[model samples]
Target: MSEIVRKESFKHVSYLWDDDEAAKLAGDEVALLIYRSNLLGADLRLTNYGGGNTSCKAYAKDPLTGKEVEVMWVKGSGGDLGTLKKSGLAALYVERLRNLKNVYRGIEHEDEMVELFNHSIYDLASKAPSIDTPLHGFLPFKHIDHLHPDAAIAIAAAKDGKKITKELFNGTIGWVEWQRPGFDLGLKLKQCLDENPGIRGIMLGSHGLFTWGDTAYESYINTLEVIETCATYIEEHYGKTRPVFGGNKIESLPWEKRKEQAAALAPILRGFCSSERHMVGHFTDDERVLEFINSNDLERLAPMGTSCPDHFLRTKISPLVLDLAPDEDLSDTSNIKARLVPAFEAYRALYTTYYETCKHPNSPAIRDKNPVIILYPGVGLFSFSKDKQTARVAAEFYINAINVMKGAEAISEYTSLPRQEAFNIEYWLLEEAKLQRMPKPKALSGKIALITGSAGGIGKAIAVKFAEEGAVVIVNDNDEARLAKANEEFGKQFGKDVYITAKLDVTKDEDIQAAFDAGNIAFGGIDIVVNCAGLSISKPIEEHTDKDWDLLYDVLVKGQFKVTQAAVAIMRKQAIGGDVLNIVSKNALVSGPNNAGYGSAKAAQLHLSRLNAAELGADKIRVNVVNPDAVISDSKIWEGAWAEGRAKAYGITVEELPAFYAKRTLLNEIILPEDIANACFVFVGGLLNKSTGNVLNVDGGVAMAFVR
Candidate 1:
């Protein structure tokens, strides 16, 4: 079956070319040059909505007076390439931009430095240079373009972006990880150029694409061709899954009505930012828009933080995940406005609290809370800026970000850096100054994770997953033999450093706290959790006693909650975000028969996760769920008399149980422990930093039985 793939999926640094034509391009024709810039600009596949920038050096007679001066016609910092006219471009002394990156060694005063950079630009446009001007300056080539291309970034965002880029670029291009995209990027790029004098292009992981040439057209054409290659590569490897938009569910509104809705929502959203007057882009991509609008959890899952680092200086992290429907436009902007002001205020409060919690005693002062982006349902996304350009850039970046998010969801899961980690990236001066930086989400080092019930199957898989990814794993189980078996297996498979086993009844308070304390002592702090220790009691409501309900609650719901509460104490004390994963069941959502106590307890577990999420969000604690179905593990109670009894009671043969279960899902497959482990990884790792109160269905679509 043909899968749905992102339209523009590719690697960025593949544009490195070094032929005779590239070696001698000073005399390239002007029309050719214009075409080149436009083609490079048209690489919206790699660079949509002018997200990337390009510059070329030229000697021109002053239009106002008749004096010749050499300057760079750089794409204006915030204009969309889709409609970037020549007149919209800015002119600054190339020598000055280069000197700024080169001569300015270590300027401490930000204001003074801004002033010095301004002095370098003789033109009175007063427009700020692209934050990446230093990157352009440091590159040896005369023609340069930098873009946050979707195609290129698709590869860059991968865990193996560097390895992929190396395979793609081989010896011709260089690669960097995602870094803060200004002076830091420039400095890193400067070093790269020095080290690889023959390097023709640079690919920044998790950021976007960069290409340069001696002439404008060469750089542009090379960027396009390379992006195309990367796109083909992605299509071949990760062939996309085409999730259809089941559409025409709602009536389409006329343009006049749409305009009215846009106007109504604009003013209130404008209040979130300093921009008084705003421009709103109304889109009818309702079917696609509503997918996210309705998915409260997706909002929680998305990196809703700034689309990129440059956006952070303007918008703090991201706008509140707007709660809305895809096709339903916000009819009352005023009401949303009322809701948003408080939300922004809350965001600011949380931001301040986070700073207090995480900042060192002698750290630099944190910046102010200035909102830059605001998301609205059915209306696409809004970028708020004092100028039309910044607002437009904001909108474009947001749209691209949403697309990337959508694509990421179809894959495994898309994650972002943790809030505190992002804060460090946003504020670290040394981190901020390197041009060749690719900012990685922090690794799982210096962190600990506890997996309850890990001695068996699902929990065991999750424990191994965490350990493989560098986190110290604490495996918990009530059964000493099973726990020891897990410890032995992990030690033999991955070595002793990866796994540690302890016996504990998750329901016991002392056991819960002791587990956490031991984990803290072992791994410095508890950062992740996988609560897979729930007892599944297969009994119909009539047959189930109150005692059965209580036991289910104690083991399935309260036990997980207590363990999480204990871990949270350590996590809060350390001031780092903590993640808790409740391994519930598809039976929580869907049921045939004989799952009363189990299902009810699982329902309670879901509620518990959400409550803790809301309560502990301020403490940087995240709580979510992994709903697994029909697992073949030591924890699979169906193997016991009760499960067989349920099958017989329901008039189903034991041989038909798995198939009977498989028919319920859109995808017919067994729900494996590794499947649960993958979803767990998203929750614990940097990817799902902002994700809380989420229910990830590891049930192979079986839960459709409930919704249907």
Candidate 2:
């Protein structure tokens, strides 16, 4: 028996399959395949994000023929296994797939082969099939799994991987030489399987593991068996190769200290990364990253690049390492900035050379030359992408690569995929076509914004608008309950990574700093600031109290000033021009009865915006005004005494206040929070992007409030 078949239980990797869960879907092979895939994908040790494919062959009734047909259900292209669902699996006609061999011209017609997959699709509702569909279809097994488990890949990427596979799995596992994944690679997998009838699986050279069986459980268990056995073998050899990664060359910073350093460097690195196109960033101080970066071999291995296609496709060909002495202070950002400029320039030049050296006549043009993954020895890793989730997954994939490198170097000499081979995969025509099909990025795609008082009212509306247009938002509000609900709402609307929340009381400088600090660290830095935090009191000049004036000025005038100042400092540091929007009022321009403290504070806020706009224009920071009068829906202020105060000012009941305000406007329409939000988007959403130090009113057209 093959060593993998003889193994009854796992020794290294976790056996996550619960018989009860499997029994619930026993009759459905496709559901069982999805269940097994999720279990394997949930563990990063098995596969990185969107890294592997799984499939099972099953009998399905043909709609037109009314007869059972052999069909293949495989994970679709760009689908994550852990989150795989019925919609994520592509259904293909197995007999049709098998017949494609007659038309398979050769590997040179790979792109044409992908087009043929459309012809073999069994279900119209099915997602697009993956490139590895042929790898599973050509095999004889009823079920199959192709995973990039670190341990197996360690064996696959080792110099003596083929030799290691023979000894490790005995006769049960076979091996194939390195080839980029495509129809040719699929044929090689089939050849390996046909030649070794008794083997349970094959190891794809410098790539990953392939395991199969008759049933879903059998296939899933067989995979765990192979991976766990390889883990056990690597561990035994790893013991002999003591001091992994040639031992850590520098002591890792304390967890808190490392986070502090990461926060400081994130924006600076993000700024450099945004040279070609603005990029959002994700930071990680995970122990895996800390250990790898602090190691002596990191300088040697990180530059050599990642072995697995999954790793390099996300992390790029090589990482840009920002090494520092043990005693060097990262707090001196200027010093770090000086080093990063040259480092980024050199990395871009080298990447361009790689493209020039390996370009084929029809190869895709060179992509973003900036390093996707950036390393800071004492801090951790920072990954930059067009959006939050991509940036985060890039970091996670790099961590997986770190594990693979550690294992390979422990048991055998680690070898990266050849640069030419990597270049082929990176610029493949099929991959380029996939990228082209993605929807164009939104206006605020790579920008991060901070919107104060964002738990509700105009603030939340602005936050939601920005998030919709593809900006990561820092939503700030002082109300704990409202903030939590906003968090839940935003998480449900947009995936959780798109926005973050912070408790903010605009009157307090500490709270202001905390919010900005949270914004800077969570998302590289804030490129847009909207100051909408305010409360109003409609009182006669004599009746206005010291408490009333202080509160109004605190939130409206002074608070907006402090937040803008903080945002500007970071914007200047980022060297990327930004947008500053203030939510002033009609009261700032037009004098009205029964208004003293609130109107004066708003007037001060209005002038402060224009003055800052005048000075900050030199920094390319555009400060503008969105004067929204009587915004009522979902407003915290309108829900409380402010409504009563405003109603009293108009000599009307609170219920009649909406109509009273609307009647006064030129358009005779009630102003909604969303209306203000739409106006805010106009200023920063690249529409009125050039018009700064200007005012746009969103009050259903209050004629007196027009900008001077």
lDDT of 1 by residue, 176-206 (tens): 7666656657778878778877876787766
lDDT of each: 0.62, 0.88
Which ranges of candidate 2 are over 4 A from the true structure?
A: 1-12, 326-334
On lDDT, the candidate that comes out on top is 2
Error of 2 at 90 (Å): 1.8
Q: How accurate is candidate 1 locally (lDDT)?
A: 0.62
lDDT of 1 at 451: 87
As a whole number from 0 to 100, the lDDT of residue 472 in candidate 1 is: 70
